[model samples]
Target: MKPGILVISHGSREAAWVKLVDDAVIAAAASPCLSDIPIVSSFLEIIEGRLIQDGIDELERQGVTDMYVVPFFISSGSTHVDEIGQAFGLPWLTDLEGDLGTFRVSANVRYGLPIDDDPEIAELLAANIAELSTEPEKEALLLIGHGSKEKMFHERWQEGLLKLGERLRALGGYKRAEYAMLLPDQAAAKLAEMQAANPGEAVIVVPLFLSRGYFTNHVIPTRLTGLEYRYNGKAMLPNQAIERWLERQMLEGLQRLNEK
Candidate 1:
C-alpha cells in the first residue's frame, strides 16, 4: 500500500477555517502521484479525533511503513514546529536507524515555511488591498499578524512581513502599507490613526493569518468594526501554491524515509 500522508496544523476553533485547510489538502492529494496515498489531517489544539500521535498510530495500524507528517506552518522558525519535532523524537532523515523497528513504520515529517516566505503571498495581499481600497492615494493597508512573545519567532514574523510590505511598496500601487501585532499595545488605536489621516478614503484591514479562528474571525473584526472607514474584511484563504509546497515537502520526507 502507498504511504499515508498526515498534514498537521496548529488547529483552530473556527470550523470553517479548519474546513478550508482540509479542502486544500484534499485538492492537492488529487494529483496523480499522490492520488493512491491516503491523506489526512489533525490539529494540535482544538478539534479532536486525530492528534499527532493518533495520525502516527493510524498509519502504523494500517501496516503503512512510510508516513509523512507535514506541519502546515508558515515558518520553520516557530517554536510549535520545534516542540512538535521534539515530542515525536523522530530525527530528520539524516539520522534514521535502519532497523525494522525504526524503518517498519518510519515517519517523515516536515514543518512548512511561513506564508510570508512566498513571493506570491505579497501579491495576494496586494490584490486584497486593491479590493479594499476605493482611493489608492488616500487609503492605507494595515497588515495584522499574530506576533509571538518569544523574541526569535516574533522577530522572524516581523521581518518577513516587513519585507513583504517593502516589496508591495516597490510595486507602487498602494499609498501606505504597514504591519501591526495582536499582542503589545494600541493596535486599534494605530488603525484609527491611519483612518484619521486618510479622511474620506477607505482603510483595508488585512489579517496576515492562515486560518479564520478566534483572532481572525472574532477578535479582529470586532475591534475594527468600531473604526471609521470602509472596513473591507478579506481574510486570507488557502491557495494552490501553499498546497503544492506542502505536498512537495511530504513527498521529500517520504523519500528521505525510504533511504533510511
Candidate 2:
C-alpha cells in the first residue's frame, strides 16, 4: 500500500486564494522525491469537502497503511495548529498511532516551521522586494503579518521578522527592512509611518502570509491607497525550499512513527 501524504492548511473563504495554495502544493508534490506519493490536501477550518478526517478516510479507503500530515503555516507557535492536532486526538505528548477499528492506520503530523527559517526563503523575499522596488536605495521592505492576540504567537511572528530582517541586512542591498503587524495597529497607519520616515522612498509591503486572502487582496491594496503611499504588494506564496522543508518534515515524522 502506498503511504499517503496530506498537506494541511488553515482554509480560506476566498476561492482564488485557496486555489493558489492548492496549486503550490500540487507543484510541490510533483518534486522528484514525492512524485509517486499519494498526496492530498485538506483544510482545518473555513473551507469545505476535505477536512482532516475526510482526507484520512480517503487515504484509508485507498489502503494506505501510513500517513504524513504537514501543516502549511508560517509559525510553529500557532494555537490553531495545536487545536487541529487535538481535534484529530493526537495530543502534544502522544505518539502518532491512529486506531481505525478494522484497519489500523499509523499517522504522523507536524506543524509550522516559518518560511523565514528556510535559507532559500530569504532569497525569495529579497527577489520579491527587488521586483517590487524600482529604487533600491529609496525603497524600504515592509513585511506585514497577521498578529495574534496571544502574546506567544505574536512574539513568534515578531522574532521571525527580526531574523529575516537580519538576513536581509547581511545581504546589505536594501535601504531598510522592517516588519509590522496588522492586528495590533492598522497596516495603513504603519505604512504611512514608514513612508513618513523615509520621504520619497517607495515601500514594498510583503504579506508574510502563507496564502493570500482578505488581507492580501483587499485590505492591503485598499490600505495602501487610503494611506496615500506609493507601494507594491504581493502574497508570500510557497517556493522550492518550502516544498523541501515539507518533505523533510514528512520524512522526520515517518522516522518517529517507525521508532514507535
Candidate 3:
C-alpha cells in the first residue's frame, strides 16, 4: 500500500503566501513519521499548476495508491472544505454545493479535517500576540475570522473559535478571549462590544488566518476602521507548530489506512 500526502490550502496570488505553505510542507516532510513518503503542497485556486488536481495527479504519477488529502484550512466551517471534499467524491462538511467541480481522483482518497481548536494552534495564536500583549491577564484577545453567512458554516466557525478562545485564554492567562468575523462586517461592533463588556481590559485583535495576506493586511483593518484595539495583524504561518500539525495529519491518515 503506497501512500502519499497532499496538503491543500486556499491559494493566494501573492508569492509569500504560497511560499509559506510550501515551506511548511518542507518542514513537515522532515518528520520521522513521513520518512520516504512523498508530500505535495497544493492550493484551492490560483497558483496555476499547483492546484488540487495537479497535486493529486503528481501523487498518482508517483505510484501512490492510498493518498491522504489534508485540508490545510483554518476552520471546518470554510465552504472551500466542503467544496474540496465534494470534488474528491467525499461527503460534504456543509449543506452548500461545491463549485470546484470533480477531480479525476484515481488514488484511494482519505480526506482529513481542518485546523479547528487544536491545542497547539491555540499556542500559536497566543505566541503570535505575545509581543502586543503587554499584560495578558488584563487583555481581551479578540479573534477575527473570515466568517460565513450560511447557518451551518457560521455555527461551525463559532464553535471552533469558542474552543480555541478557551484554550488561548488559559494559555496566555488573558482576562478573556472574544471573536469577530470580517464577513457580515462585525469587527467594529465586536471590538466595541468587547471593550464595553470588559471595561478596563485591553482588546487585542488577532486575525485567525493561515497566513499574512489581503485579509490580515487590508480587509480586517478596514473593518475595524474606528475601533480602539491593539492589532499587529500577525497570522498563523512561518511557525513550526503548523509543520507539526501537517505531520500529524499525514500520520493519522496512514494510521487509518493501515487499520483498513
User: Each model's number of backbone clashes?
Assistant: 3, 0, 0
Give me the candidate number with maximum TM-score.
3
For residues 122-235, write the lDDT of model 3, one tens digit per residue: 889888888988888788888889988888899999999899988989998988888887766788898888778767778988889988999999998887887688889889
TM-score of each: 0.76, 0.78, 0.96
- The count of backbone overlaps in candidate 1 is 3
Give the poorly placed runs of model 3, Cα more than 4 Å off. Answer: none
Compare the candidates by lDDT and give the number of the best one.
Answer: 3
Give the backbone clash total of model 2.
0
Off by over 4 Å in 1: 1-4, 64-66, 75-78, 90-110, 170-172, 192-202, 238-241, 251-260
lDDT of 2 by residue, 1-260 (tens): 35677778888777876787787777777767666667788887677677777777777777666676677776654556555665655654233222322222355433333354455667666665565656666667777777665656667767887787767645537687787777676577777788887777776676777765677777767656756543445556746655566667666655654555
In model 1, pairs of residues that clash are 74-113, 74-114, 75-114
lDDT of 1 by residue, 1-260 (tens): 35677787877766888888888777777778776677777777777776766667777676665666777775554556656665666543323222213222355443333455566666665666665555566666677776655666677767876777677755546677777777554468878787676676566676776765677667777766677655445555666665666667667766765665
Full-model lDDT for every candidate: 0.65, 0.65, 0.88
